[model samples]
Target: MTLAIENGSGKATQWQKVMVVAEPTRESAAALHYVLSRVVFDNDILYLLHVENPTFWKTCFKKQSSSTSREGGGCYGGCIGGDVDFLDQMKSACEVVHPRLKVKVSRVETDAKEKAYVIISETKVHGIDLLVVGKRQSLANAILGQSINGTIRETAEYLVENSKCTCVAVQRKGQTGGYLLHTKTHRNFWLLA
Candidate 1:
């Protein structure tokens, strides 16, 4: 079955707070595009949640310009590195589709917690009605024997099972095919256009 999206803005529905875990990945951008173009309504609040992993800094940045130490090279603070550009593009696309939609940027640190747990916490704290995250299979996943189809990595799976709000883990099927959608009750369901 396809993922159902109701765009009945004329109906009397509660204002929704929809959060999408934004990362600098093709799958993440696809998820954002899906939500902006389908799931979110004009009155909904869209939140882009970025969880900064300190370990990522080791490979991505040289120094901490805002808070602490400089490690290897350049500065990185208040930025999701250069990937924030993609985030801006996603926001612009959302605005073009939903001019009245309110998009909020939430930047948080993992703070040594599991990323999934951090996401769940944020969902509860924000009282989100819906949450979306990208699902992708990596080489490490294959080596770890997590080569299951339609099942996302640990983060999306854990978020789906534990988050307070309804969660969707999605991977784009192709440029025009639609998406591979997963939810608490659905796994690897293909939502074709």
Candidate 2:
């Protein structure tokens, strides 16, 4: 792929809406970084979507509960401080960049399993041109079946297949330093940038 780091190639074009899914994890942070550093260009409206899964407390955090501070008095002050840090960086990036970027944040309440549907609806609502989601992969999907719910991190896969616009599911590839991207056209493609 062309890594020109430019919005449009050979023509003056700007995507109206670019939606990037936001979560508190480092995977999500990397996705946001990818959007801000690589995909976005002048006049693009950036959208940060945080799907607040109502059952996340019960469903997502079990032994991995320590990853996010859902402990100590039920997911309020002790949860998701990474999001605030990310937002601050986002704002700073917008201010520093030459492009006049506009960012909008949305928080939608839904069940964990239906996250893909909610994301798809948001794209339709905003007419998003490109959608970016941080993929949190689970070995359980392979060990168990795709029918499982609690470790339902496969929502990105569903979105890649179903979203009306171009959807990219990003997963950071640890210390090797790369990203694993899933698109309608690509599966587990290693993206160096």
Candidate 3:
């Protein structure tokens, strides 16, 4: 499958279906919905994937086990986590714009690195023409100098460089309601220049 974006001027062009991969986050969900609404296409599919990375829990368990000498050591109370159904949330969110869009949800338990590989592989298996991902913002990226955005950037660059499909990284920006006007004005200025 090949995804092509064409300006809706006066020309004949082929339109391929677009696949959007949205993680279950408020920002990501909002951005996905916004992009889908803005884009005019006949064939489009939205894929929502929830990846549960075990590294966070593994590290937490390791730290708790090392601090105590009991056979079953427990420093912090073990509480049940991972019960949140992100896929369900995504489904409900997408249902708001039903009939106009086709949405699919999948839940996978894998680390970030493994998840990235799975996404790439699935893109091929599912005949995805384009891959859309969200850019996450965290304080660690600001202070610790590492973040999910960096991983996404590296992953996107590698995929775009190596794969045959097109990749897009969508970020949630504040709605100014002047983007269209700004772009047109800029274009006019450039033409005059």
Candidate 4:
């Protein structure tokens, strides 16, 4: 937990390392992208983290060669390595929006039910200052209830409740099909769409 001294205010502000939880869904990326567009500092590090479930055998060994980027609407090939397609897209999007910001990608394998715990552990180990996650409706929510994407939302909520660092849960404005433009200065507050 390093404190950065501000020149004007003469106050110490902690805004160095930030971690964003990335999922395969576009909403997840968009939420992270929204965060990136709003927050910027002189020397900040952005971490993109994706947790994979061992139970999902389909993506366990799906490796592609170091070829060109994928066409149409699919994962990019050989972006970070093989099989880390989600991180690839996220990194690319963040670079496009904030080219100067230092960005890193991390992929972890964990139990299906322990995603939140893994993220919290990583945040502590990495000395993260903020943790950002996307909130969206999952397919299971349709079958179960319509509050949120059950597992991921639960993970975000747990992080918000228990993490030593700050936590932010972003959601797309689905009703009006808008975006969350501002969440930096207005902590826990969101703009329309």
- Each model's Cα RMSD: 6.6, 6.3, 9.4, 6.3
What lDDT score belongs to each candidate, Candidate 1 first?
Answer: 0.76, 0.74, 0.53, 0.68
On a 0 to 1 TM-score scale, where does candidate 1 land against the true structure? Answer: 0.74
- Cand. 3 TM to true fold: 0.56
Winner by lDDT = 1
The backbone clash count of each candidate, in order, is: 1, 0, 0, 2
Off by more than 4 A, model 3: 2-16, 40-43, 55-84, 137-163, 177-193
Candidate 1 local lDDT, 1-193, one digit each (tens): 1233455875544578899998777778888988977798877889999887877666455444443534433543333544347567777878898999999888787753577888888888988889999887667664765435545456776777777789998888878999889888987798885
RMSD, model 3, all Cα superposed? 9.4
Candidate 3 structure quality by residue, lDDT tens digits, 58-145: 8766666575554345433332224566567666766675555667776567776776677677777777766656544456544644
Put the candidates in TM-score order, highest first.
Answer: 1, 2, 4, 3
Residue 138 displacement (Å), model 2: 1.8
Question: For model 4, how does the per-residue alpha-carbon lDDT over 131-176 read when each residue is reduced to its tens digit?
Answer: 8887654576546752354444456556666788877767677656
* TM-score, candidate number 4: 0.66
Candidate 4 achieves a global lDDT of 0.68
Residue 108 error, candidate 1, Å: 0.1
Query: Comparing candidate 1 with candidate 2, which one achieves the higher lDDT?
Result: 1
Which stretches in model 4 have alpha-carbon errors above 4 Å?
5-15, 58-84, 138-153, 174-189
Q: What is candidate 2's TM-score against the reference?
A: 0.71
